[model samples]
Target: MDKIKGIAHKYGNNINTDIITPGKYMELSIEEMAKHAMEGVDPEFYSKVKEGDILVAENNFGSGSSRETAPQALKQAGIAIIIAKSYARIFYRNAINIGLAALELKEAEEILDRDELEVDMQAGTIFNLTQGKTYRFTPLPDRLLTMLEAGGLVAQLEQS
Candidate 1:
Protein backbone atom coordinates (compact mmCIF):
# COMPACT_ATOMS: atom_id res chain seq x y z
CA MET A 1 0.00 0.00 0.00
CA ASP A 2 2.59 2.53 -1.10
CA LYS A 3 2.33 5.59 -3.29
CA ILE A 4 4.58 6.72 -6.14
CA LYS A 5 4.60 10.17 -7.66
CA GLY A 6 6.67 10.92 -10.73
CA ILE A 7 6.81 12.32 -14.22
CA ALA A 8 5.52 9.92 -16.87
CA HIS A 9 7.38 9.04 -20.04
CA LYS A 10 5.09 7.70 -22.73
CA TYR A 11 5.92 5.00 -25.24
CA GLY A 12 4.02 3.33 -28.06
CA ASN A 13 2.68 -0.23 -28.42
CA ASN A 14 4.50 -3.55 -28.70
CA ILE A 15 7.67 -2.39 -27.05
CA ASN A 16 9.56 -5.63 -26.73
CA THR A 17 12.29 -6.83 -24.38
CA ASP A 18 15.02 -6.50 -27.00
CA ILE A 19 14.24 -2.83 -27.32
CA ILE A 20 14.17 -2.45 -23.57
CA THR A 21 17.70 -3.64 -22.86
CA PRO A 22 19.04 -4.71 -26.26
CA GLY A 23 20.73 -8.05 -26.85
CA LYS A 24 24.24 -6.66 -27.04
CA TYR A 25 24.11 -5.31 -23.54
CA MET A 26 22.92 -8.59 -22.08
CA GLU A 27 26.40 -9.46 -20.96
CA LEU A 28 26.75 -6.27 -18.94
CA SER A 29 25.91 -5.79 -15.30
CA ILE A 30 22.57 -4.31 -14.33
CA GLU A 31 24.13 -0.90 -13.78
CA GLU A 32 25.71 -0.98 -17.21
CA MET A 33 22.71 -2.50 -18.91
CA ALA A 34 20.64 0.39 -17.61
CA LYS A 35 22.67 2.81 -19.68
CA HIS A 36 21.32 1.19 -22.85
CA ALA A 37 17.71 0.97 -21.80
CA MET A 38 15.26 1.91 -24.56
CA GLU A 39 18.16 2.72 -26.78
CA GLY A 40 16.60 0.77 -29.62
CA VAL A 41 13.37 2.71 -29.57
CA ASP A 42 14.28 5.93 -27.82
CA PRO A 43 17.92 6.67 -28.18
CA GLU A 44 17.78 9.50 -25.66
CA PHE A 45 15.91 7.58 -23.02
CA TYR A 46 18.87 7.00 -20.76
CA SER A 47 19.99 10.59 -21.02
CA LYS A 48 16.56 12.00 -20.23
CA VAL A 49 15.46 9.65 -17.48
CA LYS A 50 15.90 10.30 -13.77
CA GLU A 51 15.25 8.36 -10.62
CA GLY A 52 11.60 7.85 -9.67
CA ASP A 53 10.31 8.50 -13.17
CA ILE A 54 7.36 6.42 -14.43
CA LEU A 55 7.09 4.70 -17.82
CA VAL A 56 3.71 4.63 -19.53
CA ALA A 57 3.15 2.52 -22.61
CA GLU A 58 0.28 1.74 -24.99
CA ASN A 59 0.02 -2.07 -25.28
CA ASN A 60 1.84 -5.40 -25.40
CA PHE A 61 4.80 -4.02 -23.58
CA GLY A 62 7.65 -6.46 -23.16
CA SER A 63 6.37 -8.46 -26.08
CA GLY A 64 9.56 -10.15 -27.16
CA SER A 65 11.90 -12.62 -25.50
CA SER A 66 11.29 -13.69 -21.95
CA ARG A 67 14.57 -12.37 -20.72
CA GLU A 68 14.48 -11.10 -17.15
CA THR A 69 17.17 -8.56 -17.96
CA ALA A 70 14.57 -6.31 -19.52
CA PRO A 71 12.89 -5.59 -16.22
CA GLN A 72 16.21 -5.49 -14.44
CA ALA A 73 17.41 -2.77 -16.79
CA LEU A 74 14.35 -0.67 -16.13
CA LYS A 75 14.71 -1.13 -12.39
CA GLN A 76 18.34 -0.13 -12.47
CA ALA A 77 17.48 2.84 -14.64
CA GLY A 78 15.33 4.19 -11.82
CA ILE A 79 11.91 3.49 -13.21
CA ALA A 80 9.63 3.44 -10.20
CA ILE A 81 6.67 1.97 -12.07
CA ILE A 82 5.28 1.09 -15.49
CA ILE A 83 1.66 1.71 -16.50
CA ALA A 84 0.44 0.18 -19.72
CA LYS A 85 -2.66 -0.83 -21.63
CA SER A 86 -1.46 -4.42 -21.54
CA TYR A 87 1.63 -6.39 -20.69
CA ALA A 88 3.11 -9.61 -21.97
CA ARG A 89 2.58 -12.33 -19.40
CA ILE A 90 6.22 -13.19 -18.98
CA PHE A 91 7.22 -9.58 -18.65
CA TYR A 92 4.59 -8.99 -16.02
CA ARG A 93 5.86 -11.90 -14.00
CA ASN A 94 9.48 -10.85 -14.44
CA ALA A 95 8.68 -7.33 -13.36
CA ILE A 96 7.04 -8.42 -10.15
CA ASN A 97 9.76 -10.92 -9.49
CA ILE A 98 12.30 -8.07 -9.57
CA GLY A 99 10.20 -5.62 -7.55
CA LEU A 100 9.36 -3.40 -10.50
CA ALA A 101 5.85 -2.03 -10.11
CA ALA A 102 3.70 -2.47 -13.23
CA LEU A 103 0.02 -1.67 -13.69
CA GLU A 104 -2.36 -2.58 -16.50
CA LEU A 105 -4.67 0.32 -17.21
CA LYS A 106 -6.68 0.58 -20.40
CA GLU A 107 -6.65 4.35 -20.02
CA ALA A 108 -2.91 4.51 -19.93
CA GLU A 109 -2.85 5.74 -23.52
CA GLU A 110 -4.42 8.98 -22.38
CA ILE A 111 -1.41 9.87 -20.34
CA LEU A 112 0.97 12.17 -22.19
CA ASP A 113 4.70 12.30 -22.05
CA ARG A 114 6.15 14.17 -19.10
CA ASP A 115 2.80 14.26 -17.39
CA GLU A 116 3.08 14.27 -13.65
CA LEU A 117 1.43 11.23 -12.09
CA GLU A 118 0.52 9.92 -8.70
CA VAL A 119 0.02 6.16 -8.41
CA ASP A 120 -1.60 4.71 -5.32
CA MET A 121 -1.17 0.96 -5.32
CA GLN A 122 -3.38 0.53 -2.29
CA ALA A 123 -6.31 2.28 -3.93
CA GLY A 124 -5.55 1.05 -7.45
CA THR A 125 -5.73 4.58 -8.80
CA ILE A 126 -3.63 6.64 -11.12
CA PHE A 127 -4.03 10.38 -10.84
CA ASN A 128 -2.81 12.43 -13.75
CA LEU A 129 -1.68 15.61 -12.10
CA THR A 130 -0.97 17.31 -15.38
CA GLN A 131 -4.23 16.38 -17.08
CA GLY A 132 -6.41 16.60 -13.98
CA LYS A 133 -7.86 13.13 -14.51
CA THR A 134 -8.01 9.94 -12.50
CA TYR A 135 -7.81 6.40 -13.83
CA ARG A 136 -8.82 3.26 -12.02
CA PHE A 137 -7.03 -0.04 -12.52
CA THR A 138 -7.30 -3.48 -11.01
CA PRO A 139 -5.06 -3.78 -8.02
CA LEU A 140 -2.34 -6.38 -8.03
CA PRO A 141 -3.10 -9.55 -6.13
CA ASP A 142 -2.14 -9.62 -2.45
CA ARG A 143 0.67 -12.11 -2.99
CA LEU A 144 2.20 -10.10 -5.80
CA LEU A 145 1.91 -6.93 -3.76
CA THR A 146 3.68 -8.59 -0.91
CA MET A 147 6.49 -9.69 -3.17
CA LEU A 148 6.97 -6.20 -4.53
CA GLU A 149 6.85 -4.70 -1.03
CA ALA A 150 9.52 -7.07 0.15
CA GLY A 151 11.72 -6.18 -2.83
CA GLY A 152 10.87 -9.07 -5.14
CA LEU A 153 10.74 -12.85 -4.96
CA VAL A 154 14.25 -13.43 -3.69
CA ALA A 155 13.87 -10.97 -0.88
CA GLN A 156 10.46 -12.31 0.04
CA LEU A 157 11.80 -15.85 0.11
CA GLU A 158 14.71 -14.80 2.27
CA GLN A 159 12.39 -13.12 4.75
CA SER A 160 10.45 -16.33 5.23
Candidate 2:
Protein backbone atom coordinates (compact mmCIF):
# COMPACT_ATOMS: atom_id res chain seq x y z
CA MET A 1 0.00 0.00 0.00
CA ASP A 2 1.03 3.61 -0.41
CA LYS A 3 2.29 5.74 2.48
CA ILE A 4 -0.31 7.16 4.86
CA LYS A 5 -0.46 10.93 5.37
CA GLY A 6 -2.72 12.60 7.88
CA ILE A 7 -3.06 15.20 10.62
CA ALA A 8 -2.14 14.02 14.12
CA HIS A 9 -4.36 14.09 17.18
CA LYS A 10 -2.10 13.70 20.21
CA TYR A 11 -3.03 12.29 23.61
CA GLY A 12 -1.24 11.68 26.88
CA ASN A 13 -0.17 8.44 28.56
CA ASN A 14 -2.35 5.59 29.85
CA ILE A 15 -5.26 6.36 27.55
CA ASN A 16 -7.43 3.31 28.10
CA THR A 17 -10.12 1.69 26.00
CA ASP A 18 -12.81 3.27 28.11
CA ILE A 19 -11.56 6.65 26.98
CA ILE A 20 -11.35 5.46 23.45
CA THR A 21 -14.96 4.42 23.48
CA PRO A 22 -16.91 4.61 26.75
CA GLY A 23 -18.63 1.50 28.07
CA LYS A 24 -22.03 3.18 27.87
CA TYR A 25 -21.79 3.00 24.10
CA MET A 26 -20.90 -0.68 24.04
CA GLU A 27 -24.32 -1.67 22.77
CA LEU A 28 -24.06 0.60 19.77
CA SER A 29 -23.21 -0.58 16.30
CA ILE A 30 -19.78 0.27 14.86
CA GLU A 31 -21.04 3.33 13.01
CA GLU A 32 -22.96 4.53 16.03
CA MET A 33 -20.08 3.78 18.39
CA ALA A 34 -17.76 5.92 16.28
CA LYS A 35 -19.68 9.03 17.19
CA HIS A 36 -18.57 8.44 20.77
CA ALA A 37 -14.96 7.54 20.13
CA MET A 38 -12.57 9.54 22.32
CA GLU A 39 -15.53 11.29 23.87
CA GLY A 40 -14.21 10.68 27.36
CA VAL A 41 -11.01 12.52 26.55
CA ASP A 42 -12.21 15.10 24.09
CA PRO A 43 -15.87 15.92 23.77
CA GLU A 44 -15.24 17.38 20.33
CA PHE A 45 -13.14 14.50 19.07
CA TYR A 46 -15.63 12.96 16.73
CA SER A 47 -16.68 16.27 15.33
CA LYS A 48 -13.10 17.35 14.59
CA VAL A 49 -11.81 14.13 13.10
CA LYS A 50 -11.55 13.78 9.33
CA GLU A 51 -11.15 10.66 7.31
CA GLY A 52 -7.53 9.37 7.26
CA ASP A 53 -6.62 11.24 10.44
CA ILE A 54 -3.94 9.79 12.70
CA LEU A 55 -3.97 9.37 16.48
CA VAL A 56 -0.70 9.72 18.42
CA ALA A 57 -0.53 8.96 22.10
CA GLU A 58 1.84 8.14 24.92
CA ASN A 59 2.50 4.77 26.63
CA ASN A 60 0.01 2.15 27.78
CA PHE A 61 -2.63 3.20 25.31
CA GLY A 62 -5.71 0.98 25.26
CA SER A 63 -5.06 -0.26 28.82
CA GLY A 64 -8.60 -1.06 29.84
CA SER A 65 -11.07 -3.78 28.80
CA SER A 66 -10.37 -6.02 25.83
CA ARG A 67 -13.56 -5.10 24.05
CA GLU A 68 -13.01 -4.82 20.32
CA THR A 69 -15.31 -1.80 20.17
CA ALA A 70 -12.44 0.60 20.86
CA PRO A 71 -10.60 -0.14 17.68
CA GLN A 72 -13.77 -0.65 15.71
CA ALA A 73 -14.92 2.80 16.79
CA LEU A 74 -11.68 4.32 15.59
CA LYS A 75 -11.77 2.47 12.28
CA GLN A 76 -15.35 3.43 11.67
CA ALA A 77 -14.49 7.03 12.44
CA GLY A 78 -11.91 6.94 9.65
CA ILE A 79 -8.76 6.85 11.72
CA ALA A 80 -6.11 5.63 9.36
CA ILE A 81 -3.54 4.77 12.04
CA ILE A 82 -2.60 5.03 15.71
CA ILE A 83 0.93 5.56 17.01
CA ALA A 84 1.70 5.14 20.70
CA LYS A 85 4.64 4.46 22.93
CA SER A 86 3.04 1.15 23.88
CA TYR A 87 -0.34 -0.49 23.57
CA ALA A 88 -2.22 -2.95 25.74
CA ARG A 89 -1.72 -6.39 24.23
CA ILE A 90 -5.35 -7.06 23.45
CA PHE A 91 -5.89 -3.60 22.03
CA TYR A 92 -2.91 -3.97 19.73
CA ARG A 93 -4.26 -7.23 18.41
CA ASN A 94 -7.79 -5.92 18.08
CA ALA A 95 -6.61 -2.90 16.08
CA ILE A 96 -4.94 -5.09 13.48
CA ASN A 97 -7.75 -7.63 13.46
CA ILE A 98 -10.09 -4.83 12.49
CA GLY A 99 -7.71 -3.19 9.98
CA LEU A 100 -6.73 -0.13 12.02
CA ALA A 101 -2.97 0.19 11.90
CA ALA A 102 -1.33 0.65 15.32
CA LEU A 103 2.37 1.30 15.81
CA GLU A 104 4.58 1.48 18.90
CA LEU A 105 7.33 4.03 19.07
CA LYS A 106 9.37 5.56 21.83
CA GLU A 107 9.11 8.94 20.13
CA ALA A 108 5.36 9.00 20.03
CA GLU A 109 5.27 11.85 22.51
CA GLU A 110 7.23 14.01 20.13
CA ILE A 111 4.33 14.26 17.77
CA LEU A 112 2.06 17.25 18.27
CA ASP A 113 -1.59 17.78 17.57
CA ARG A 114 -2.36 19.10 14.09
CA ASP A 115 1.02 18.03 12.86
CA GLU A 116 0.94 16.40 9.46
CA LEU A 117 2.52 12.96 9.34
CA GLU A 118 3.53 10.73 6.52
CA VAL A 119 3.78 7.11 7.64
CA ASP A 120 5.38 4.37 5.67
CA MET A 121 3.99 1.17 7.14
CA GLN A 122 6.47 -1.02 5.32
CA ALA A 123 9.48 1.06 6.34
CA GLY A 124 8.15 1.71 9.83
CA THR A 125 9.08 5.35 9.52
CA ILE A 126 7.05 8.41 10.42
CA PHE A 127 7.92 11.68 8.77
CA ASN A 128 6.61 14.80 10.43
CA LEU A 129 5.81 17.22 7.70
CA THR A 130 5.29 20.14 10.02
CA GLN A 131 8.54 19.69 11.92
CA GLY A 132 10.65 18.25 9.16
CA LYS A 133 11.82 15.28 11.20
CA THR A 134 11.44 11.53 11.10
CA TYR A 135 11.00 8.73 13.66
CA ARG A 136 11.25 5.00 13.31
CA PHE A 137 9.45 2.06 14.84
CA THR A 138 9.27 -1.66 14.28
CA PRO A 139 7.10 -2.64 11.35
CA LEU A 140 4.28 -5.10 11.79
CA PRO A 141 5.06 -8.75 11.23
CA ASP A 142 4.32 -10.29 7.87
CA ARG A 143 1.17 -12.06 8.96
CA LEU A 144 -0.34 -9.01 10.59
CA LEU A 145 0.71 -6.82 7.67
CA THR A 146 -1.04 -9.20 5.33
CA MET A 147 -4.20 -9.07 7.42
CA LEU A 148 -4.12 -5.28 7.62
CA GLU A 149 -3.49 -4.94 3.90
CA ALA A 150 -6.46 -7.16 3.19
CA GLY A 151 -8.69 -5.02 5.46
CA GLY A 152 -8.54 -7.07 8.63
CA LEU A 153 -8.61 -10.74 9.61
CA VAL A 154 -12.02 -11.60 8.20
CA ALA A 155 -11.17 -10.13 4.82
CA GLN A 156 -7.82 -11.88 4.86
CA LEU A 157 -9.45 -15.21 5.61
CA GLU A 158 -11.88 -14.81 2.76
CA GLN A 159 -9.02 -14.09 0.39
CA SER A 160 -7.32 -17.31 1.35
Candidate 3:
Protein backbone atom coordinates (compact mmCIF):
# COMPACT_ATOMS: atom_id res chain seq x y z
CA MET A 1 0.00 0.00 0.00
CA ASP A 2 1.04 3.60 -0.45
CA LYS A 3 2.31 5.63 2.46
CA ILE A 4 -0.46 7.25 4.48
CA LYS A 5 0.22 10.74 5.66
CA GLY A 6 -1.84 12.30 8.44
CA ILE A 7 -2.06 14.01 11.78
CA ALA A 8 -1.95 11.76 14.85
CA HIS A 9 -4.46 11.63 17.68
CA LYS A 10 -2.34 10.34 20.52
CA TYR A 11 -3.56 8.52 23.64
CA GLY A 12 -2.31 6.48 26.59
CA ASN A 13 -2.56 2.76 27.48
CA ASN A 14 -5.47 0.35 27.80
CA ILE A 15 -7.83 1.98 25.31
CA ASN A 16 -10.49 -0.70 25.29
CA THR A 17 -13.21 -1.31 22.71
CA ASP A 18 -15.87 0.02 25.08
CA ILE A 19 -14.20 3.42 25.18
CA ILE A 20 -13.76 3.17 21.41
CA THR A 21 -17.48 2.69 20.87
CA PRO A 22 -19.67 2.22 23.89
CA GLY A 23 -22.18 -0.63 23.94
CA LYS A 24 -25.00 1.85 24.38
CA TYR A 25 -24.48 2.90 20.78
CA MET A 26 -24.47 -0.66 19.47
CA GLU A 27 -27.92 -0.29 17.93
CA LEU A 28 -26.77 2.60 15.81
CA SER A 29 -25.28 2.32 12.34
CA ILE A 30 -21.51 2.53 11.99
CA GLU A 31 -21.84 6.12 10.90
CA GLU A 32 -23.92 7.07 13.93
CA MET A 33 -21.91 4.92 16.33
CA ALA A 34 -18.71 6.58 15.14
CA LYS A 35 -19.90 9.90 16.47
CA HIS A 36 -19.76 8.42 19.94
CA ALA A 37 -16.38 6.82 19.46
CA MET A 38 -13.83 7.78 22.12
CA GLU A 39 -16.49 9.96 23.74
CA GLY A 40 -15.86 8.28 27.05
CA VAL A 41 -12.22 9.30 26.82
CA ASP A 42 -12.37 12.41 24.64
CA PRO A 43 -15.70 14.06 24.05
CA GLU A 44 -14.33 15.95 21.03
CA PHE A 45 -12.59 13.04 19.36
CA TYR A 46 -14.99 12.66 16.48
CA SER A 47 -15.23 16.39 15.94
CA LYS A 48 -11.53 17.15 16.09
CA VAL A 49 -10.34 14.23 14.02
CA LYS A 50 -10.32 14.65 10.25
CA GLU A 51 -10.52 11.96 7.63
CA GLY A 52 -7.23 10.06 7.09
CA ASP A 53 -6.01 10.92 10.55
CA ILE A 54 -3.86 8.36 12.40
CA LEU A 55 -4.62 7.14 15.94
CA VAL A 56 -1.61 6.59 18.19
CA ALA A 57 -1.88 4.90 21.55
CA GLU A 58 0.09 3.04 24.21
CA ASN A 59 -0.26 -0.62 25.19
CA ASN A 60 -3.31 -2.87 24.98
CA PHE A 61 -5.40 -0.83 22.60
CA GLY A 62 -8.82 -2.42 22.17
CA SER A 63 -8.55 -4.35 25.40
CA GLY A 64 -12.24 -4.70 26.16
CA SER A 65 -14.99 -6.63 24.37
CA SER A 66 -14.37 -8.43 21.08
CA ARG A 67 -17.09 -6.68 19.16
CA GLU A 68 -16.36 -6.08 15.46
CA THR A 69 -18.26 -2.82 15.75
CA ALA A 70 -15.39 -1.15 17.57
CA PRO A 71 -13.06 -1.30 14.60
CA GLN A 72 -15.95 -0.53 12.29
CA ALA A 73 -16.71 2.56 14.31
CA LEU A 74 -13.10 3.71 14.02
CA LYS A 75 -13.00 3.13 10.25
CA GLN A 76 -16.27 5.02 9.92
CA ALA A 77 -14.79 7.78 12.04
CA GLY A 78 -12.01 8.39 9.49
CA ILE A 79 -9.09 6.82 11.25
CA ALA A 80 -6.78 5.76 8.42
CA ILE A 81 -4.69 3.59 10.71
CA ILE A 82 -3.78 2.94 14.36
CA ILE A 83 -0.32 2.81 15.95
CA ALA A 84 0.10 1.41 19.43
CA LYS A 85 2.69 -0.14 21.71
CA SER A 86 0.74 -3.39 21.75
CA TYR A 87 -2.77 -4.55 20.94
CA ALA A 88 -5.23 -7.17 22.14
CA ARG A 89 -4.65 -10.03 19.65
CA ILE A 90 -8.33 -10.29 18.78
CA PHE A 91 -8.50 -6.56 18.23
CA TYR A 92 -5.61 -6.78 15.78
CA ARG A 93 -7.31 -9.41 13.65
CA ASN A 94 -10.66 -7.66 13.89
CA ALA A 95 -9.04 -4.43 12.76
CA ILE A 96 -7.52 -6.16 9.73
CA ASN A 97 -10.83 -7.84 8.92
CA ILE A 98 -12.55 -4.48 9.15
CA GLY A 99 -9.96 -2.83 6.87
CA LEU A 100 -8.33 -0.68 9.53
CA ALA A 101 -4.57 -0.98 9.70
CA ALA A 102 -3.28 -1.28 13.26
CA LEU A 103 0.50 -1.15 13.73
CA GLU A 104 2.65 -1.81 16.77
CA LEU A 105 5.66 0.31 17.69
CA LYS A 106 7.13 0.20 21.17
CA GLU A 107 7.88 3.91 20.96
CA ALA A 108 4.29 4.82 20.14
CA GLU A 109 4.14 6.96 23.28
CA GLU A 110 6.72 9.32 21.80
CA ILE A 111 4.34 10.39 19.08
CA LEU A 112 2.48 13.50 20.21
CA ASP A 113 -1.10 14.51 19.58
CA ARG A 114 -1.61 16.31 16.26
CA ASP A 115 1.89 15.48 15.12
CA GLU A 116 2.26 14.94 11.42
CA LEU A 117 3.05 11.35 10.43
CA GLU A 118 3.73 9.47 7.23
CA VAL A 119 3.30 5.73 7.47
CA ASP A 120 4.30 2.99 5.06
CA MET A 121 2.15 0.13 6.33
CA GLN A 122 3.74 -2.59 4.24
CA ALA A 123 7.22 -1.51 5.27
CA GLY A 124 6.24 -0.78 8.89
CA THR A 125 7.85 2.65 8.76
CA ILE A 126 6.59 5.73 10.55
CA PHE A 127 7.97 9.17 9.95
CA ASN A 128 7.16 11.84 12.53
CA LEU A 129 7.48 14.89 10.31
CA THR A 130 6.85 17.36 13.08
CA GLN A 131 9.76 15.91 15.03
CA GLY A 132 12.02 15.11 12.11
CA LYS A 133 12.29 11.50 13.18
CA THR A 134 11.45 8.05 11.87
CA TYR A 135 10.44 4.80 13.59
CA ARG A 136 9.84 1.25 12.49
CA PHE A 137 7.63 -1.64 13.52
CA THR A 138 7.39 -5.26 12.46
CA PRO A 139 5.81 -5.40 9.04
CA LEU A 140 2.60 -7.33 8.48
CA PRO A 141 2.79 -10.68 6.71
CA ASP A 142 2.15 -10.84 2.96
CA ARG A 143 -1.29 -12.43 3.26
CA LEU A 144 -2.42 -9.85 5.77
CA LEU A 145 -1.00 -7.14 3.55
CA THR A 146 -3.04 -8.45 0.66
CA MET A 147 -6.20 -8.31 2.76
CA LEU A 148 -5.43 -4.83 4.01
CA GLU A 149 -4.61 -3.55 0.54
CA ALA A 150 -7.90 -4.92 -0.72
CA GLY A 151 -9.68 -3.10 2.11
CA GLY A 152 -10.43 -6.11 4.30
CA LEU A 153 -11.05 -9.81 4.01
CA VAL A 154 -14.50 -9.47 2.49
CA ALA A 155 -13.21 -7.25 -0.26
CA GLN A 156 -10.27 -9.58 -0.81
CA LEU A 157 -12.56 -12.57 -1.11
CA GLU A 158 -14.78 -10.68 -3.49
CA GLN A 159 -11.81 -9.85 -5.67
CA SER A 160 -10.91 -13.52 -5.88
lDDT of 1 by residue, 23-112 (tens): 998999999999999998898888888898999999899998999999999988889999999999999999999999999999988999
| TM-score, prediction 1 | 0.98
Worst 10 residues of 3 by lDDT: 119-128
Backbone clashes, each candidate: 0, 0, 0
Compared to the true structure, candidate 3 yields what TM-score? 0.98
How high is the CA lDDT of each candidate model? Answer: 0.93, 0.92, 0.94
TM-score for every candidate vs. truth? 0.98, 0.97, 0.98
Candidate 1 residue runs with Cα over 4 Å from true position? none
**lDDT accuracy of residue 51 in candidate 2:** 96
RMSD list, candidates in order: 0.7, 0.8, 0.7
Q: Give the CA lDDT, 0 to 100, for residue 115 in model 1.
A: 99
Ranking by lDDT: 3, 1, 2
Q: What is the lDDT, from 0 to 100, of the residue 80 in candidate 3? A: 95
Model 2 scores what on Cα lDDT?
0.92
Query: What is the number of residue pairs that collide in model 3?
Result: 0
